[model samples]
Target: MNKGLLFSCLLVAVTSVQAAPISIPYQGFFQRLKQVNKGNYPLVEIAFSVPNKSKCLIKSGTITTETESFPLTITQDQRIFLPYDARLKSDRALVNLDIKGSADNCNISMQVRAKNTKQSYSQKELLELQAEMNTMLSDMQGFPMRYFSQDIEGINFEFESGSQTSVKIDGQRQVFTDKLRLSQEQLNKLSVVEFDTKPLVISPWTHG
Candidate 1:
């Protein structure tokens, strides 16, 4: 092959590899555990994300403390469930991800989520959870953005399928579905959030 052609081919190959996704190590304060330790939220989840075209799959993973290691499996949706563990609450933990296939094409990132317990929450408790979630969001934002950006505009709560869960915000009862979005306006007026059934997950929600 001509020297010029060979150089061009090499450049293209390098570019392709460089463009591939890479796994991201977890960082920031483990606020999910703090929320779980509060005892209101019983479940926490570490959710992973990968590009649709990426070949990165998490075969297995572990959350290890100084003395103990807990084996965990990622679900099809790329989620690892971590139920509230009193031991892990105070102990510092390290998360290790085991990626399947080539590391080059696999780009995995994670976000922590807090899940509601089976018991319904009263207005006071719901407001407390919302406040805690906002705090957690702030911690995750970090640095300049954390200082400049306003708190999350809304709250998105996900409920189990086929379950009838409802929340009354400011005396206005809203039924829950797969996803429920409470806008900033609604949240400002939120004095009462009464849930009939607990939600599966709670997250920050911003309108499109």
Candidate 2:
């Protein structure tokens, strides 16, 4: 599938849920971008608030490149992961979230450093990403897949629930809402979520 066409398809899908809250966690974007480039699966955690009250579940979806469309597998825990192909330029990659369930509106954000990152991309960062994509050598240019790393991480647009109801970043209480664009101040002060998934625990044992 043509990546352009695929993005178009996914963009259309985005519109259907445009009214819902969707955002990219700008603070930890660099780390997530690294993961994407390295072909690692970047997990997206979506939270929902139901004015009408409905449950949502994402079963499966596809990630497309110019030549191929990869399958995105969903775990029972509601984490969405994908085998991102390094050969493809993902700067403009679109994620078509296949959501099941209901709600008055769905809140979407990216999980960066185990904290929900707002989906707003910084203008400068966006420009830089575009430049990188423009400079990246493609498979068509005789570059091998491995050499064509630096996969662009796609912004997440869909989620369920978590223990952490809300978070504070940069000394500001951050709560995600249904909004497409964000301001410069918000982008500049975007918080880097500091939650750790695992912490070491000690058990007493006697050693001679």
**Strongest candidate by lDDT:** 1
Give Cα-based local distance difference scores for all models. Answer: 0.50, 0.32
Report the C-alpha lDDT of model 2 over 103-201, residue by residue, as the tens digit.
Answer: 223333332221233433344543343333323222212211132233323222222343222333444554443212223344345544321221111
Q: Where does candidate 2 clash, by residue pair?
A: 21-178, 23-119, 24-118, 24-119, 24-120, 25-117, 25-118, 37-151, 46-159
Q: Candidate 1, residues 58-123: lDDT per residue as tens digits?
A: 667787777977786667666655545555656766556566556555544444455545434454
Deviating ranges (above 4 Å) for candidate 1: 1-57, 62-70, 73-77, 81-107, 140-147, 160-177, 188-197
Cα RMSD to native, each candidate?
12.0, 16.2
Q: Model 2 — which ten-residue stretch has the worst lDDT?
A: 199-208
| lDDT, model 1 | 0.50
Best by TM-score: 1
How many collisions between residues are there in candidate 2?
9
Model 1 poorest ten-residue lDDT run = 6-15
TM-score for each candidate, following the candidate numbering: 0.49, 0.30
